[model samples]
Target: MSAVTIRAARPEDAGTVLELTRALARFIKAEDWFLATLADVERDCFGEAPRYEAWLAEVKGASAGLATLFPTYSTFKAKPCLFVDSLYVDETARGYGVGKVLMRHICQLAVERGCVRVDLNVLNWNPARSFYTGLGMQETGELGMTITGPAMRSLAGLD
Candidate 1:
């Protein structure tokens, strides 16, 4: 196995990030709901006042995985928390410890940033739940709710 190298994603990596993201969405059977574009990736990750940060994992100089995350405040802990928005490893890269490496890198970054914890939402049926649990992540037993599309617009009184 070639050594895996993880690094911060740059503008030129937008396409790679989007490709991996689409693959993930497809894996979860949510491709119909995956509306993100390459432009969105570039803008959100590399634009001024970046809303989030992205990291890429490469094995033998080939893209293997990617992680996108942002920081949030933990009012209860009185410290910041790192929320991993997405973590994915390509099919060809699975079983090679790429996901584990990416996750550990995220945790290391959280520690270096003085974050009190790391957070992420995983689908109930995702088999990766076991992988996450293996990394010491516990299921919160909380339901995730969302209101998007017209409902969100109406809630914001944009209609």
Candidate 2:
């Protein structure tokens, strides 16, 4: 096995990134909601004034995983926070420390950007929880909530 390299994703990596996203969805049994397209990724990840950033993990010159990151503000801390929207290692690459490398890269980036902290969510039933805990990530016990789709429309008085 060749050395693994973690690097910032480029616009051309949209297709591969989308594939990784689908793999993640399937792994979590949420493929039914995986409707995003390559164009959507390109537009959202590399458009003029991109809203998010992504990183790629490559092994032997092949894509192995991806990490999508974005910025979020902390009202109480009054500082910037780095939010990891997703950190997925392909099934073939799971045992090779690929996820850890991606996470460390993200953390280094957060520090460079002057972020106060880095945040990400893991599913309770997912085995990745152990991997996160092994990295010294603590559970703050804060529940993550979402108001999207129909609920979001209703909240906006569009119903």
Candidate 3:
């Protein structure tokens, strides 16, 4: 096993991050669901007043995985939380502790940012359930919901 390093993702990393995102969508059988482009990633995550933050993981100088997240407030918990938008470890990097390394990095990051918890959404069928549980993450049992595209427009009276 070689040293694994996690670094803040830069605009130039948009392409690789986008590639990993495609891989993740395909792995979850939602290959056509993503409509984002590298420009979107670069603009939203690297532009002025960035909306999100990301970390790129590398093992022995090779891309290993990525973790993208944002800070949120937990009204109920009365503390800040780190909301993980995505955490994708390449299949080839599985069983090599890449996921664990990325997760630990997020944990330490949350602490440094004064966050009391971390939140993320995992597909029900994703096999990483055990991995997350092993890290002490548990299902919150809260139903997740969202409105997008036409639905979002209609809800906001923009349609």
The TM-score of predicted model 3 comes to 0.95
Clashes of each: 0, 0, 0
Worst 10 residues of 2 by lDDT: 1-10
The Cα local distance difference test for each model comes to: 0.93, 0.91, 0.90
Candidate 2 local distance difference test against the native: 0.91
RMSD score of candidate 3 (Å): 1.2
lDDT of 1 by residue, 58-141 (tens): 999999998999999999999999999989999999999999999999999999999999999999899999999998999888
- Model 3 residue 23 CA deviation in Å: 1.1
Report the alpha-carbon TM-score of model 1 versus the true structure: 0.96
Mind giving the per-residue lDDT tens digits that candidate 2 earns over 1-103? 5678998899989999899999999999889989989988999999888888889999999999999999998999998999998889999988999998998
